[model samples]
Target: MRRPQATPARVIVFGAGATGARVVRMLAESPEVGRVEVRDPDTARLRRTVDSCDDSVTAARGLEMPPDADMVVIATPTGTQAAAARAAVNAGASAVTTSSEISETRELLALGSLAAENGVALVVGAGFMPGLTCLLARAGAAEFDLVDEIHVAKAGTGGPACARQHHRALSSLAIDWRDGSWTRRSGGSGRELCWFPDPVAGRDCYRGALSDALLLVPAFEGVERVTARLAATRRDRLTAPLPMMRRPHPEGGVGAVRVELRGRRAARRHVAVLGAQARPAQGAAIVAAATALHLIGRADVSGAGGLASIRDTGRLLRAVADRGLRPCRFEGFTLSRDETPRP
Candidate 1:
């Protein structure tokens, strides 16, 4: 069962940085949306984003969300996402955020309960790893009656500060699902080689600690093992996090995720893989747009819950692909019970 689609007449967006600006522009391109308002402390960024969009979007500075707004998107830094999300839900609007700090997010599940009670959607971690990874896992899990394990890996190049931040974030401790409960291990300690799809295959990756799958994967029955990995070239790993480096050069990159399952359909094993060559900014924009549309009832979210889950996996994949932002591909294959897994 699913709710009827109700196009949002008004939408509000917080933050006007690179990610925020991109989300505003993409939302404005949608004809179904009515008014799109952007709020940010930086007037210059506000102006730039507003100038990029059509007349339907306006710069809303030092202002509150219109109670009539159907949805509010928070694209600010991770540190302030909880506050922004809390305010949006309290203001009676559906909320979405692309935050990397989901574990530290305060009371978001509690707010989701309130939103559900109020007939609104409150979704967190709508960005890449949390966003697309969740969707891909769900889609793959659907193909089999017994999901055995899932692994998600993403690789990309950026500035030294960005790399350092990513390293520190996941370097603390890694958690994964195993034997019906969660297990802990050292971050970047479990080294494994993975063969991603073309353009970035056969790379060595280390298990990462930060992943929204920690929360979502447990929901699936028979999912005993779940982990996420991040890979960088040896040179990039050695130099990208160097604080003394004035600038870092671009490195070849690719993002890939896969799921393994065993089911009764044919007493066989199944594998599904999703890969893409994309910038983090592009992935964030695609996800933010999908979340907005889902919140407003435009996209099909048949089995979605209070939190983030892409129930209508095909629709979500289509939405992201239709955006034409980057090179993306998907595939599903079957293997024998005795076969050794590759990547």
Candidate 2:
């Protein structure tokens, strides 16, 4: 495990939406976290979010990043993530954000020099799919000598914000990395059967969003193909054009993320799967905390660089376990050519 740091005595969280509130709660609940300030234009929400946590939390106004904050978490809309992250790094605070598509990540990457100049790390995609998926892909990639393809699939029930984001994403084109470049397709295209754990067994998932693939392609060396899919429900499929009206799933939030890597390890065809299960918010908070803690620990490291999530696979998994996610909840298995049945 990476050494815990006392440097992030305080944290500043931007936005007071569903994910932001959860992030604040997770940080405030931590004994090591000193102070947590939540900012939002909605005064009532900011107050409610701050009040929900312990005395360590306070409500703040505006999007300004706190200079004293050791780390800043941007949980605002996907569109605003780049700007928020830029502000956080400029304010001299190491930062992480849950929202950022491939394009937005490019904008965030452009700020790498600024973050470096300020002597801080700026990490994007610190939430569940993009964050955890990125970490998991990297982890799975490490076990193989050469990677040929990568696929990630997720199933979960998210809140209103998540629903809206889903609606928006599905209403548009989803892209994936193939043949060394991005390939765009309809939101619900590329249907395939995906299996999760017990609760969410075999179900039809489609290539819903390509953001994870985008992050993986660059982060995972020598990957030719990267694909990410979202579990598609009947309602989700029908409501693709009108996402705002989509009905919520009746089941209590149970979700899973599985990463599959096909590569050569020891001169044999190797296939691997790495996965985890939790509520969307819970998973998001776990990755968010892990990213924040990582930056906090590296506060004094010189040279600024922007990466998606915790780069160290072992450290990332360890951090995930430390933050209430049991190792059993996250599963990994590998299969070799000799064990495979040829068609």
Candidate 3:
């Protein structure tokens, strides 16, 4: 759970789907939360998930809501971050998001301003993958006094629905952040990165397919190079459906994340973080809900306004534990010709 601000907070999460519910469960069980409110366009789904919780949260549709909610977790797709951030701050609350690197939503740039104006925070890209990966980068950059390079890799089992959503539409442009500018890498232009030190699997690199490295590299500073590689369960030439636009309830599956940081150090080393939810409908709800409460409780979230990162979420796992959810495990080490652990 996030550490509490001076006053008890009430949180609202948009899009009451799988991940949203997880974030909610985390919030309801949190001591930091005074009242839990959930809002979604889908009233039926909202009612159903609310019933499962311990009578802590009041569920409502988008149009009707409580006087004020302290924080909002935008569990919507990648494209909706800007609108979601606006809605939450407008409603007198801070915001959190799962759209790791939502590029299409340029309106997010104004969140800092809105948050400043409202005296409430509007944070984005706080999901497990980018959020957690960024945390590792921060930890690494801090661990090593002088840093020159940074690299990140993630692999996981995606739901059939999310995969299909990827197929729903192809991202018109593949981009990343560089020196405060957006640079487009050719769509499907990246090469296969050999992943060697997965926490679950000791050392095996799979064929890591496409990603938005071009846009993200610039946003990350003090690094000579930064690469974020992704591995999904099935890699067809076909792209997965866009989760930002919509979320289709897919069949069951699991997913994991593995990241590495290489800089001025003697050798290229790997570090990993993993997250997975089984039983699509229920699991997704849990992820979303869990995310919401986690952010509202963070001390890092200044005056209830600003962007929050996954790296700032170790405390949230405590609430995950309260719900009997297991936090992702961390394991792995630098590789040397003779240092690889023997099976």
lDDT scores in order = 0.63, 0.73, 0.50
> Candidates' TM-scores?
0.82, 0.88, 0.70
Give the Å shift of residue 10 in candidate 3: 1.2
lDDT of 2 by residue, 203-272 (tens): 7888765477656776666678888888878877887886356455422377877777788877778887
Candidate 2 — which pairs collide?
116-304
List, residue by residue over 1-343, the lDDT tens digit for candidate 1. Answer: 3545455458889888656877888888887688899998878879988998889999886446667887888877666677777777777777877665536443565565676556666776676656666666665566666777777776653323234445554455667777778777776667788666566677787765565555466456666777777775565446533543444332223344333333333455655565555565567667778778755753333222323253455676667777863334454444435444434
- Say which candidate scores most in TM-score: 2
| Per-model C-alpha RMSD | 4.5, 3.7, 6.4
Which of the two, 1 or 2, has more lDDT? 2
Model 2: lowest-lDDT 10 consecutive positions: 301-310
Q: Which segments of model 3 are wrong by more than 4 Å?
A: 1-7, 63-66, 157-161, 168-172, 177-182, 194-220, 232-235, 238-252, 265-343
> Of the pair 1 and 2, which is ahead by TM-score?
2
The residue ranges of model 2 lying beyond 4 angstroms of the native Cα positions read: 1-8, 246-252, 300-310, 327-335, 338-343
Number of the top candidate by lDDT? 2
| Model 2 TM-score on a 0 to 1 scale | 0.88
In candidate 1 the C-alpha lDDT for residue 134 amounts to 67
